[model samples]
Target: MSDPATNPPPAEGEERTSDASSTDETVAVVQAQEDEPNFTPITKDFGFLPIPKHLRHDPKHPAYFGLLLNATFGFAGTFVLANLYYCQPLLIQFSHTFNVSYDTVSRIPTLVQVGYAVGLLLISTLGDLVRRRPLIIMLVFICASLSIGLSFTTNFAVFQALCFLIGVFTVVPQILLPLAADLAPPERRATALSIVLSGLLLGILLARVLAGVIAQFVSWRVVYYLAFSVQYVVCVWLYLVLPDYPAKNKGATYFGLLWGMAKFAVTEPQLVQAVLISIPSAACYTNFWVTLTFLLGGPPYNYSTLVIGLFGLVGMVGVGLAPPLGRLIDSLVPWFASVIACVAYILTHVIMVGADGINVAAVVIVCIGIDVFRQMVQVSLTTAVFSLDPAARSRMNAIILISLFIGQIMGTAVGSEVYTQHGWRPAAALNLAWSGLMLFVVLARGPHVSRYTWVGWEGGLEVRKSKVTAQKRRDEEAGASDIQQRGDEKHALEAKQSVREEKDLQDATTVGMQEVKISETSEGEKQGEDQPPMVEVATLSAE
Candidate 1:
């Protein structure tokens, strides 16, 4: 006889069994999805691709394939976000081309960021509310159109308005970063985010370098033209080939989504503190980049745009190091990393304060240091925010990006106003203020809410309710309840046994009495019969 566990499956029944199991599993998955009221991931196909069911947005896909997809997203993000920074290096050129004051031209960068802030706030939440592919594609087309228009338009006012619109449309890449985090496996999510973020940082660096170099060879309008053409092609390819990932917040209305993000920013203390620290941190990074072009363009240094742009290449040293900083945030406590980063920020700012123009080496070294440390702080803080709510990853990211961009606006506005008016030293003083603010955010207090509430990773906010101790306490309570139940059962059994014994004893006594009465009656009957007959026992008793 074959053991049931070892028996081979029937060949014909295999298909039936597989089909039935798949059906049941699919139904169960649908039901489970319906039961969850909060944060249901969108899983339906766009009806565009006829690929196999398991391939699209399957978190269990091969790790290598996931990485490849992430890399694609990263590159896409780089190209899109590069639009924001290309104008930064071109500020001097814009001032010259438009025959405007440097101060007036500076508003172009600030307005672009302002549009970015508004767009980020408005469109950032769209990632969760709508289909990412169509939303992103729509934005791409608009950006492409705007880019082409910017290349041709001679009117400065129209060009300035287009800059804002360009900033709005370019946030497609911002949407993709949270998407990367969403699709990435939990074990590798941080690293995956870092890899994608590396593309973004590289784009920031190379946008200046490339813009500076390309503008030297041609006109700045060529930059927008190239971007427009390339983006149009990318948009088409993305529409045809990109896999659909549905929104988790598909049910939320537009107003509801934005309102919810605002609510999250206000309510979650970790998020609030994270934003606070990042504001100045962004101020520091953006101020340096925005002001550096001006500093190098003026004064004893009097560097050309190409040379100033090459300095962005030196900052590329920090770009390559970004992944390692992300890894550090993952491995170490994020709060600790943030504090150390804050210290580095302070020291770098001090170094910049001393560099009065002749010391190009100090400026270069300090700029590099500033980029690395500032990015580390950013990565650490961002990673810390992710721990607050995993289900709200997109919303959390929206909050984060919105907060950072707010700082971007601040930084750009400050750099444009202060550096153009009061010179570089006062600007450096503002950076020192940023560093001081970052340190205060780190060591001053913990979150008003709790930490370690979601992910188990260590962040700047470190509060965990003890799991092991709670388990032990629950076990003790259970043991005591079980002992009391058993004791009650034992007493009930003894009482039942005593009642059974008493019932049997009472039956025995009644039977004995009956037997004794029967014997006495028989003896009386015999005596009456012997004495002879008179109406039986009654007559005998009368006589």
Candidate 2:
């Protein structure tokens, strides 16, 4: 995530920046990075510590057990919503099987996107207000059942409706992502969040590949059946194994919480920027995959669904490379990682736009680059959102997710229309435009971290620490440091001893007083001055 110019140069023949006609301001910035010493993150020491031994092995640590749970949940989430993507490359086959038009099969994916939009708005919104564990578990089970039911239906209409329902429940993974963030230690938060997000990225890419392979070997229905089984097991595991996260908005009603989230999101400039920037980047990422299938399936090569699926494995290489890139970013200069991620995304989409008609090998390379850039950007955004409000992490995440959902809908819609009218190039162009806009937001806004001001109880702790350190330094200068330390320690020890001695003395004093009272009562000494009076009173009562 180092600045692009600070990035290590390629071997001699690679294309470096060509800035003949560009504005002087941008050219100067680019040139400045190149002219400066090759400073990478390796020189910086601001990174988080490595994972600790106890946490590394502990099942309770989210990275260990939580990773598997999150990934399993991810598989199910993808199983539910990702199947909407199945008919993209396989539309021709689906058309033949269902005796429907190719365009009609296209509606299935579109409807799924619509369903996803609804889920993000409703289910994901509700996810933050309640106990996340039970809600996620319920969604997973419901989505799984629906997917399983999908395998049995021969009707396309039923299939589309089921896909929509699956989208509705697929918000569970999105819900759990913030939970993973919540569960992770602060130092390791980004890395853990990335691990869960990796599951999401893989699910998105792999669903296409897995579906293609299954459709080639067996019927498309078999794909849903497999998803249903995997999801059911994962759902059961999630219910049993995943712990419930208490809602942080404890005092607020559900409607109040939702209203607060909305109000805060719109008012916060950083959150607003996040939504605006993500809308397009997500659109690009979504559009690429959605359109790629159609282009590949209808061309000179006429690749089968399975072969198109194989290309998804290319994305795996990028996924593997991303963490290292992130590690590098984290190691870099303060406040530069996010900038690097954003810049990389912009360039990557530019490359993607021009990659059409390029050789398959070259296109694969570009796709991998795109994948790496996208993943890095996502990691940066995830880190940025959680940083905004650790307590409100879920709602903040929900906002970003909701934006991405909207982005998905727009991207899918535009890709569909553009592909129908112009071609893949137009879709790619649209994606690049969005990437450019994201870059503009990045440059204009600096980094999202800049706007964050520490608040709440921890902010009080920070203030106290600052004051304590300052007082200590002032005392040292005044020649009272040693004297104060001696007095503080002595006073603390004396307070402890005083408390113990007081308790012991009180116990002994109470015992002595009780013995004296008991002796007096036994002897009937209380009526000693009035012995004749007590005898006369008893006789009168008897008479």
- Candidate closest to the true structure, highest TM-score: 1
For each of the candidates, give the backbone clash count: 0, 2
Query: For model 2, which pairs clash?
Result: 41-331, 41-332
Stretches of candidate 2 above 4 Å error? 1-100, 293-306, 325-335, 353-355, 413-430, 448-543
Report the alpha-carbon TM-score of model 1 versus the true structure.
0.72
Error of 2 at 477 (Å): 18
Best by lDDT: 1
TM-score of model 2 vs. true structure: 0.66
lDDT per residue, candidate 1, 133-222, as tens digits? 667777878888888888898888988999998987788877877666555433344566676777888888777777877887899989
Residue 142 shift from truth in candidate 2, angstroms: 0.8
Instruction: Flag clash pairs in model 1.
Output: none
TM-scores, one per candidate? 0.72, 0.66
Error of 2 at 161 (Å): 2.5
**In model 1, which runs have C-alpha deviations exceeding 4 angstroms?**
1-65, 89-107, 153-158, 236-242, 298-300, 356-358, 415-426, 446-449, 452-543
